[model samples]
Target chain A: MTLSSISSLTLRKTPRISDAEFADLRGFIYDVTGIDIPERRQYLLENRLGARLAELNLKSFAEYSSYLRRSPSKDKELVYLCEKITTNETSFFRDSKQLDVFRDFVLKDVLESLQQDGRKELNIWSAGCSSGEEPYTLGIMLHEMLRMSIIGWRIRISANDISTAMLNKAKDGVYNQYSFKTTPQEMIEKYFTKEPGGFKIHPKVQRLVSFAALNLNDRMALKRVPKSQIIFCRNVIIYFDEEMKKKVINAFYDNLLPGGYLILGHSESIHKFSRVFKPIIKPGGMFYRKEG
Target chain B: MVLAKDIKGADGGVFLAAGTALDDAAIASIAALGAPFAYIKPNPAFTSPEKDLQRIESFVRYYFQYVDPDSPLFNELFRLVMERVFEASQKGWAIPCEYERQAKSVEHLHDLFFRDQGASLDLVKHETSLSSFPDTYFKIKELLDSPASTAADMAKVVSADVSLAAKLLRLVNSPFFGVAGRVDSISHAIALVGVSELATLALGISAIKFFKDIPPELMDMETFWKHSLRCAVFGKCVASLLPGLTSERFFTAGLLHDAGRLVMFKNLPYASVQAMLYARSSGAPLLEAEREILGFDHTEVAGLLLEEWNFPAELRSIIAYHHDPLLSPAPRDAAVIQLADILACGVEISSTGMYSLPGMTQEAWNLLGLKTYDIDKLIRLHDKYFQELTSVFF
Candidate 1:
């Protein structure tokens, strides 16, 4: 079928999920996932997640939402659906000012401490690493700053996602040079081994990260993860309603060691949720530390 | 199959005008005769995406066929694509794809003429291996951008690079800038050459560095260096003879006038030299020989090479059409260089050095707005100063 025909058929067959129905589905997603779906933001839900409905061969948003709830065969599909609907825009050394601060303070402090303790390893976690971009970015920065190969460091990174599709991409560490728009050529050349069409992180960087499916709402899965020195749950908790945000923050507080770091996107803050973490403001960006 | 030196015969190879197949017999015959050049009708069936590719190919064929071997069309296709590549580069677009396309087409054409018969077509893969200076250049820019770095500090930065220092020293000691006495160290050379001259010289050296890996055959590296130096000497002499022209920049232009020849010879060595030899033996102009041999001439190559080096567009035009001064968009420093090249050749030959390129007297006479006697005076002045110029560099 022609592209236009397919689009038109899609538009016609679905009785334009009513405003109330759209609201209810958003509410259901937020209730199950603890992701806050803001009121009157059905347009965003429709534009970004509408493709998932079509992919499932569901005639309307209602059927897709119901399938998400009740289908026994939907576990794999649900994971993929979460991944498909999620945003994955990121690159190496993104937000240069923030990176500058990390380079000056955080990385310097970590390395100096490591030198003192005679410990070479450092662990970093990028929770909700959509399409692997954030963790890969982390890998690139760490690889560049460290200069020495990660093989000797025993540096292990844990990247978890609610979406299976994104997890798969993260595990398969292939990326085009385009994904490196913000990255310097020298960085790309140094960190990435040239693949035929693009570049791949060296196996050392790739082996540093482990990808797994995780639902943060499930407390059991949270317990399995080891304490992290640094947690980057950037832009993830912005979707969580206030109460859910508090719960997630509490989990992060329990998960991080004393004086361990927590980073959030520019739009997010943990101050209102709980007083467990204190802010460390630097020239380029901000970070928080778990209170003693 | 012929060593380049031995195949200096008259230019009477096949022209495979429209409709003839580029088959074994035709290719073999063309290869065997080795007349330095032959024209082949661009396969009409193959549509050129650039629309100008065939036109460029045809221009190369015609440039050498009719124009001097050193004319700009000998490697027209290579020159045009190179020009576009450099232009795109200035706009911050690496555009490796377009560069690769040009590299492939030029390599394919070079193979047709150079590779042994029945050799695998894949023998020469296209390379986008042109050295990129984006990062290093940015570093230099950062150094320059610091408000704290004084002009002397900046001059020291230029002086720090041994190559740039050597070139500047050579220019200051050159008769054009050598006021009346010899200028010795980098500081003295900077003072004598002036910041403008040093800036131009640094840029020129960077441009030359870009073509460092170009093969030996397309251009004689030592000879090219000598040619540029000679052209500068002649240009300096001519500019001194004139009033109000930037005499130093004129020498700079002369030093860089035939950069196109370097580009062609380096990348399209077989085609470039084939055109050169054909032009030499046939006594047709160098541009004509280059066109017939490789489908583009020296001026075009120089222009393209300059553009690739990110030299000013005006300078690129000057180099592109140096040999044919009348076709220049505006009067170029190349007119100065052309006059200088021809005058240097005349002086070099008169001083018992063997030379085989176009004559300088005619072009120099036009550009200098001087009579034959005046031309005679300039040549003598170059002959006298050439030794002094050589002493500085040595």
Candidate 2:
């Protein structure tokens, strides 16, 4: 074909968003979801919302922003926007190095401190947990490590996400092979049953986890979270800008018990924004703790 | 003369052994062979590509200094310019002149543009009037004005000038226009593309030729036109993104957007240099500096020139409000030229002596409704076309 045909092919069918228009949408997204859209990820916003605009017959992103504001069905559209904007790509046993640190160092230290306190209860909050992989992974680790130490210990994994769709998926507790990229076969066999649809988590493991819809941007809802001895907000804070990151970090600090552990995603760091979360360096990785 | 080492042709076969260059015949043979340099007393000023790369790095950095350092838009432009200039540097384009320009800034300000009445554009228009409007421009304008003219008449007028016809044909056949097949002749181009569009394009090309002798002190002709080529393509790309607008007129308007600035500089060198230096030293924009000294900027000058020349209303409107598009009757058209000019300024490859970027109206840019991906493709397309079409214009 001719070079002109190639040039024409580059012309997009989707109505494009200009820099100012993108900025307006970006600011609105950040205001509502606290998700920071950097200069590099403008395409993500475009690709995700281009079809939504065409479906609504909106001419520009500014018009779409207006629709989100003035339309009576905006609440439904906001949920759809949240679902589209937040990526659900994740796997069980992701980031083995950090998990190794968690399994070996954190489990021993936090448990030892809990035993000293003479409290048999353990509460863990998994913020922005998508598709149930992370919280369920933690549930399996708890079962594997405790191993019938006999009973009477209270263990619950409280998981939350902004997208109710993801919350529903998390409640379903089903997975295919892609979710087990790092989960060893025996571990999968230990905690899951092979159903016709996929691998279903055993009822024992499923009972230990509860899924809920929570918008972290809502300070009141963030306060309503169960106070926990450990909070695993992995890979979630990256979507927030510095201001929102500061807010989320402050909320996570308030929710975490004194001397409790907070494990973030391998790439996420609290040290940059907050000085209160004391760093606990381990052999392979690190976690932070609340210190008075 | 004697050679210190054996000289080989590009294929690595020895053409001359060492110490065998004392005769005129040998020198002529060396000349005929296009041998680059002799090994005698190895030239002292040679530098490595690594050092040249460092110079290019700083030059590109200096050009984009005023931009937001974290911006991906400027970063993409940075890559385009660096690639363009770096490629040229490999072909032995010396860039030391970029640094030496700091020493050449005008020290004293003068209203040199106004002090010489003979050089006044008003006097030139009223008295001399160019004897004629650059030959090809006159015929094109006459045919364009005559209501009775046909597509064949437009073709007759444009084809009378061989180079202008060739330029119009080559431009339409280019990737930007996307004409289906080869346009062999002027009539074929008029048939394929619309007659009025081709006629307008001829006028733009002839206008470029009209300002033939801008003093070397005023601007580098190659750099000026390369910038215009960039703006032309970029404006066309912007127009192409919109639904029903044709892109050729935008291309023509972009080509002649800065004709007023060229005239001001040519007629009043000292004053133009002083205005430029004032903009640089005071950190004011070039247009603002022009307005401060001369009571008007180049757009106003361009308005008078295009109006006096009896050019198309659309072309005149776009060029007149190019720098600030919001005031134009057709803000979208003016905005296309406005944005295209700023986008062209972002590239270090082709400069119009204003190192700083112009402030783009957000409303103007927003009205075009293009995404960054479109700009990315336009930059890539511009890199190819700018290189190909520089020879076509110059």
Candidate 3:
């Protein structure tokens, strides 16, 4: 019941990666993505990659390495691997741990609902997706999940930021290693081309998003924004007072398709702002869904 | 009372079925059958195997009781450890065969171990068998102490025991030692493994030979060695995996990590039983329970014994802090043993006297700089190596 014992519970029986496994993963990650995972952060690599192995049904990191190299969907899996190790670490994959919940729980259900409908169209609104990180991350993740099959579907991410300066940066799509601290070594290599100024985002990820300056306080503009099944208005909402929080939350709830999801910052909770949305909790954080 | 499970007799015939009610005749026959205990239904107080499992879940929960499980890092870690413990418990690794809580009270335990103050380990010097390590250990100790002694002199002492010499040669040449070229002689093995390191390992192997007198009722000696040898193998593997570590010292440290428990089990059977019971019922860790009762736990006891046996100061300190590795003078060395011991318990490789898994320090995990996947690989490796080494060792 004491504090120390409680913390120790989770740390107990953590699986370990061997020196060789660390070296192999580091080398493999470097070979593919050009980002160098240092030796000290070896624990981080294992923790992130361990989840992938469970999903892939592989036994060891070495096997995960092999899967990345030669699996039939190796290219697709590599994109995911890049997302996994780098996304959370990078501005490109901003709040993508929440994306895990989106991918596994929310998005699949949404895709299924779309499949059942006569038309194949998916809409995502990245409200306040500053410098285009959230939208670009979602684009990259979607790119892998659909296996480059975005041609058949009307997929669009309506990315809006209130600042023109930030919007221009998002459109420019140039980033540095500082923006990519959360990105895996391989992801930086795969999704970006290094330039004299900084790393350049691939046109493929950039093409999925269209950024425009839209203020949340402007009801006319909020109404004009596209209807979507998913909305990511993360840290931006925290700055608003309670009145604004409720109003903006209600706006998002109305803006979505019934049962649409709103992914938030890891620390933000929707319950205090509005009780309309049902929260779906997962590790690292929770996101909300508009209830029927 | 109705029987909740089948009561099989010595001949493997079912003497009573699940629904059988105990009358005078049935009670007489059950008493004559010499069954240790039986399940009685609708008695909420009686702990079923299922209840034992629940206790393990709660004990493990208490063991991990420090962190808010709401955080992502701990949430993931706690979930994985629970999964492992549950699997191990289901497979008969973590849970002991069901028994009623012991009747001995804390006051009774106080009377038995009260004389043995925690700080004064010299209290155990009177224990003749435990106090006296094997002659082979003392022989190497003599050489290790004497500056006049050469590596050949140490090798000659080990060679004097033909059985010890053969096991040493085979072990060095085996993949266990990772020695290059064939080591056919004790002198050559000593030169490769280091004289003191070889002596430490021999002392460990010989210490196992020394401590066979523990009663089955007090502790199962086989299970004790299984845990010890598992720690030994695991510790050796972990040491070699990390940089700038000598693997032999780790193996020896693992073997003797819980030496104090053996001493306690042998010398204070009543008090040790009480400590185990208190640890179980109160949900406190065994070391804490021991400190509460005897003022010190087995690690302290092991430290004293190792010091008396002239174990290297580093090795003595490593054993002393196996449970809390970060406190050790050489934290990494102690962390090596702690990691191995924690692994041994988590997999239910073998249960030490505590019969419950010990909680580990995050500092120890961090000190090793190993990833969780590495631990998974190590446990698999432990399984492969455990069976092979037990045969050579026991």
Candidate 4:
């Protein structure tokens, strides 16, 4: 049959990830990145990683796993793998309530402390920033809130993500309309300029933040980050295993200064982990505060 | 046919691996990507129309049951679409391309409409002045509303506008109306279609003129009207199934349900396109996606425009709450339009860049009191009326 005619036949067989291969792959993923894939997520791995395998011209999952283990460019491949596995679903001002708390309660408290001490410096870190929406959102909020007062204050916003691809996107600081879904129009007008493909964050807001590639599992890399008064790590820990979650929480505790705040995802909580931080319940959202 | 084995392209790369359902979008995407052919393991499911229809019904039911299980009308509408699918497959036609590449992200659309407009509900309300009602429309409506008005009174008002008079006669004499002969006289056409129905037709025609200047790049006006006409037909069909309901009003409601969307497309084509793409990718309902991307959805926009045009509260409620019928004051009327809107999308008659049908709430279904068998009959009725009614409107 001609190629055109042969194209009419429907493919019925699905590429199946065997149980043993799935276990091996999941285990390897967890060991390296601390992302825990449950048994039910075999289909997810099969679907997402199967495409990767096809691109790489690998025959089976076994070959793909071995290639990752033995390949000289394994580090590069790992980054690509992380990009596929990690869900980078984030938007500007994703949780308004949490942002309200950040603006109303947390920023006020932090500003008051800094004023009392006559310190002008403020450091904030956004973990798993994912294409820079969270950090840019923070920068915009700070700029709006401080306005004239922001000139004297030294502000540092450091954003880090596990995926280099995402970091590169964050560095570009260009975003589609999806990122501005929850953002108020005035804010968008004030902080973003409409461009051809998407919106570009204003230089004023983009200047306040810097992007870097850092895996949360890497303690040495985490130590390199400057201690911050507030750390926004929302929605990043849901992928980690229980042990990894505790380890990452500990790292956040260490990375935060006394009286610093740790903002997590709406569904995430620190109740299961360390008792070092106190949970502050505000009308908008909950955050953990390290004791002074 | 599920691919039992991998199909290699000319480049020797896997074109489509096994287990992927050869859906229309998949086929189109493969073709777009320059894949020549894919191998498939022949499945018995492809040969059985009954089985295919049953599968599609269940898939649709999964989403519909969430919205309103009490309404059997949605299931019937789904079956109608599936029957079309079966017929198309039997004819060896490729499944129609339903995927939209320029779908807008709902978030962006929301920002443009709501946040940018300072959260005002009046985005499209004042814009109604941009398209004034044709002089003939008001005179015709005035005469139709008057109790003592005769056919000559309405016809005299309509005849003042030569074009509208000609269009009215053509509509009346159309095949769908099944008149004995040509409707040559304006007064005779008014007598045949009745004063109120003629007024409704005039209103629909005049309303369509307002959107004539909408850039073709933003949306195809023909496709938009086809979608509206199909929704009208579906709404009327569903309305007829329910007793004590005016099918004509429901038809009008369905015809103009997505009128607000036209305004959005006309004013903010780029943002609207982004919202469509976002809806398709995220699997969010187009309405919700529109709300997320544009701040307020087309329903709200439609409500504002209809209110500005002095449309009846019932009609406004039907258009405004068609997405969520339970929320409307006129729940029954809203429910008919809502079910019809969903049915239109299910049958692939009209799509708002949504890949899946919006879920029906339990309240909407319970309000309609639908059953499974009624869907089969509705499908039969749809087949009878769709082409005929479409011709009349087009």
| Chain A TM-score by candidate, in order | 0.85, 0.92, 0.67, 0.94
Error of 2 at A46 (Å): 32
Better of 1 and 2 by lDDT: 2
**1 versus 3: better TM-score goes to:** 3
* Tens-digit lDDT string for candidate 4 (A76-151): 9999888766656678987675688678999888988898999989999999998899999999889988998899
Q: Residue A261's C-alpha lDDT in candidate 4?
A: 95
Residue-wise lDDT of candidate 1 within A1-292, one digit each (tens)?
Answer: 1122111111121236577778777777766667665543344345445566777777778887788778987677666555543445455554455566766777677667766788776777777876676777777677777776455676767888887776777777777644565566687777788766567877766777788888877777877777777788865775577788888778877888666788776435666557778888764467878766
Model 3 lDDT per residue over B193-243, tens place: 888888878877777666656656656677777888889889999897899
lDDT of 2 by residue, B183-273 (tens): 7999998888788888878888888877766667557888778788889988887788788888889889989998888877665555576
Write model 2 residue lDDT over A18-107, tens digit each, in one string.
899888888888888898766544544565577799999988888999998789988778878877655564678766656877889887
* Per-model TM values vs. the true structure: 0.41, 0.46, 0.49, 0.54
* Order of candidate numbers by lDDT, starting with the best: 2, 4, 3, 1
Q: Top model by DockQ, which number?
A: 4
Clashing pairs in 2: none
Candidate order by TM-score, highest to lowest?
4, 3, 2, 1
lDDT measured at residue B209 in model 1 versus the true structure, 0 to 100: 56
- For candidate 1, the per-residue lDDT at A244 reads 87
Cα lDDT tens digits for candidate 1, B35-84:
32443433457634344333333322221222222322112222332333
Worst lDDT 10-window in candidate 4 chain B: B106-115
Q: Which candidate is the best by lDDT?
A: 2
RMSD of 3: 24.9
lDDT of each: 0.57, 0.73, 0.69, 0.71
DockQ (0 to 1) for model 2: 0.01
